[model samples]
Structure formats: C-alpha cells, structure tokens
Target: MTTLLTPDELEAALRTIGAERYHNLHPFHKALHGGRLTRGQIQAWALNRYYYQASIPAKDATLLARLPTPELRREWRRRLIDHDGTEPGTGGVARWLKLTEGLGLDTAYVQSLDGLLPGTRFAVDAYVHFVRDKSVLEAIASSLTELFSPTIISERVSGMLRNYSFITEETLAYFAPRLTQAPQDSAFALAYVKEHARTVEQQQAVINALKFKCGVLWSMLDELDYAYVAPGHIPPGSFRPQDDR
Candidate 1:
C-alpha cells in the first residue's frame, strides 16, 4: 500500500510537479514571451486562447454546484465574478477580448470561436468535464496550477512589453489582476487539498489531478506549436496566420 504523505511533503510534491511539467516550459510560451512569433501567429494564439478564457466561468460554475458548504459555495462564487463580472463588458473575459481586439482579431469572430483549433477546444472542454465529473478533491487539486501563475504572469507581462511594440500594458491587463487573484485561489486550493486528502489514495489522486491539469495546459500549447510553428500543419477551418489568411 502507498504511504500517506505529510501535508508539507504533499505540498512539496505538488510544487515539484509544477517545476517540471507546467506549460511555462512549453516551447509555444517560450516563443511567445521571447517574441519569436510574428503578429499573425500571436493573433492566432490570442484568438484560440480566448476560448479557454471564456470557458473558465462555466468550469467554475460546474465545480461550484458540487461544493457542499455555503461557505465553500460563497468562496467559489468569487471565481464566477472574477471571470464573468457582475455585469457584461467587464471582468476577465472582457479583458481577454480586449487582448484579442488589440491583436487585430475581430471580436465577433473571436467569440464565435469559429477560428479555434480543434485541439484547443478539446483540451479546454475536457477541463470543464473533469471538474464536473471528478471528486471535488481532485477538482480542487486540479486548480493548484494557479500556484505557479504569478511568476509566469510577471514574466509574460514584462517580456511582452519589452519585446512586442504591438503589445501595450492595456492589452495585457487581463494578467494584472490575475497576479493577485491566482495566488489567493491557489492558496485556498492547496490548503483544501492538504487538509482533506487524508488517505494515501486521495493524496495520490490529488497529485495525479495536478498532473492531468498540467497535461491539459501543455497539450493546448502542443497543438498550437504543431499547428502554428515549424512544419506548420494548421488543421482545416482553424484560424490561419495573416500570410495565409
């Protein structure tokens, strides 16, 4: 039988997963932050990523439905507001649209998701389904990826500002609030997992959940890299770069 990990040990193990498998290590991110991608390629990324951004609230709502406590429900409800806002034309989704618009993507076309890659769609939808169908422990554990977000957001904001003239601070505003929000969310999630995952199996499941979430993120970038970068094989009907568009 697997031994149960101490809470500190489990936390360390989770951080180790982030160190090794997070999408920050993906070549697509390296290309993006390094400014190696052309404007059209960046546009393709923004357009496709908008689908993931738009789906976040729905994912949280599904998880929210599964929470057992009014306190937990109230805590999780903040995520809905963070993404969807109390009103339309605000919140993270709206900020993401600003990014897409700044990238010269038509907002209608972006929202239509008409140009989104099949892989991006599949990966993101899988996340929503995972949260809906999995154990609440696993679902919350999956969000532990947020533990690493602040660092990546800082890198991305600074790199994009320095490297891409087309990228203004306003275009990158979506990440600014996330710098604070992600840490708060992740801390709660990490504490919840460490507190609740009392058995060996549950601890292992939590670790696997983080791995699965990382795979979801990494695979999105893999598709982007395969389709958008070298030997480019963008699938039919997806957004084509400007040269091809």
Candidate 2:
C-alpha cells in the first residue's frame, strides 16, 4: 500500500480484482449463462437488472457534472447519450427494455421498480451515490467493471440463445453494441486512472473503487440468487416469479 505502482502494476492489480470479484464468477451467473435457470428465474433476473440498466444515464450525469474539464465532460457525455439516446426507442436503456419485452415482462412494470429487490435498490443506489460523492478519479475508476463485461455478455447472449426457447438474437441486441462500447469506455477510464492516480493513496483509492463497483455488481446477483436460487426467500412485495407464486 505504500509503494506507488507503475501503471502496468496498477492495471494488473485492477485486472486481478476483476478476475477475483466480478459477478460473472457468481453461481447465479453460471446457472443463468449455462442455461440451468427456468424461464421464471430468467424473468426475475431481467426484471431486477432493468433498474441498474436504466440508471446508467443518471449515474453518468452525476459524474458528468463534476468532471473538471471540457474534454472530460465531453467524453463522459457520450456515455449519457449512449444510454439515453437522442430519442425514444434508441440507446441502451431502450434496448434493455427490448430485452425485458422479449422476456415477456411489461415494460411499465419493469420501469416502475415497485418489484425491485431491496438489495438491488440499495446496491444500485449506492453506485449512483458513489459516482455523485466520490473523487473524480474514484468515480471513473468505479466504472472499471466495463473492462470485464464483454466476456460475460458474450456468454450470456450465446447461452441464452442456445438454451432458452424464448430468447432471440433480437432479445439481446442491447449487448451487441456493448461489445464495442464497453471496451471504449473502459479504455478511457483505465487510461485516465493510470495517468491521474499518481500517489500510492490515489492508486489504492482506484483499486478500492473498482472493488466497490465489483461488489455492487456482485451484490445485485447475490440478491437474485437468494430470491430465485438458494433458500428461495422471495422478500415481501418483491417481484414473484410464477414459480415462486
């Protein structure tokens, strides 16, 4: 913690965090991607995930307002446009709605977030608040999860298509753009963190920020696994899969 890491060492450390802590390693992810989940379970996953997806613009906006330079703000601005789009039926959030629609959930119900798991709400809200409250370097570092996303997404789209009768290429169209978008976004974040995280303390902060982001993502899945997989404790007032009902 005292030695300043060279950029390579820091990048390696960040990648190590992704390898160790990312949610793609979760059992629920394994089951979902391996096609072991029932339709109802998938429904629960998609429904719960909608809140996180829809919140990306707001999260980006919080950081955007805080970015100190025109360049940084402009770069961050693209993320908002990517998620929110210039019009309805465009961008990542709308595409995510396509995913839920394909899964047969009512879009209104998904957007209402009334059935959102408390853990999901808390975890995602913490992420937004992290962006809003953290140092700019830490805020950007928190988005380092994007570095690990393409792999999980590939597994998900292919796995869901192969296993689920209802899942179609169009259902997961949201991820297709992300295959490119995530890398670009993460590349910028990684470079920015490496360039600016100069002190040992700052480097550690970046590492912790990524760990926190990973924890947020991991915790969301934990909520899903608990409600849908393990002791199957569907918390009160949360969405109930027909299986659980």
Candidate 1 lands at a TM-score of 0.98
Give per-model CA RMSD: 1.3, 1.3
List, residue by residue over 119-173, the lDDT tens digit for candidate 1.
9999999999999999999999999999999998999999989998899999998
Whole-model lDDT, candidate 1? 0.93
Distance from true location, Cα of 85 in model 1, Å: 0.9
Q: What local lDDT score does residue 108 receive in model 2, on the 0 to 100 scale?
A: 95
**Candidate 2 lDDT, tens digit per residue, 81-179?**
899989989999999999989888888999999889999999999999999998999999999999999999999989889988888999998999999
Per-residue error (Å), model 2, residue 236: 0.4
Task: Give the clash count for model 1.
Answer: 0
lDDT on C-alpha atoms for all candidate structures: 0.93, 0.93
- What candidate 2 gets wrong by more than 4 Å, as runs, is 243-245
- Model 2 scores a TM of 0.98
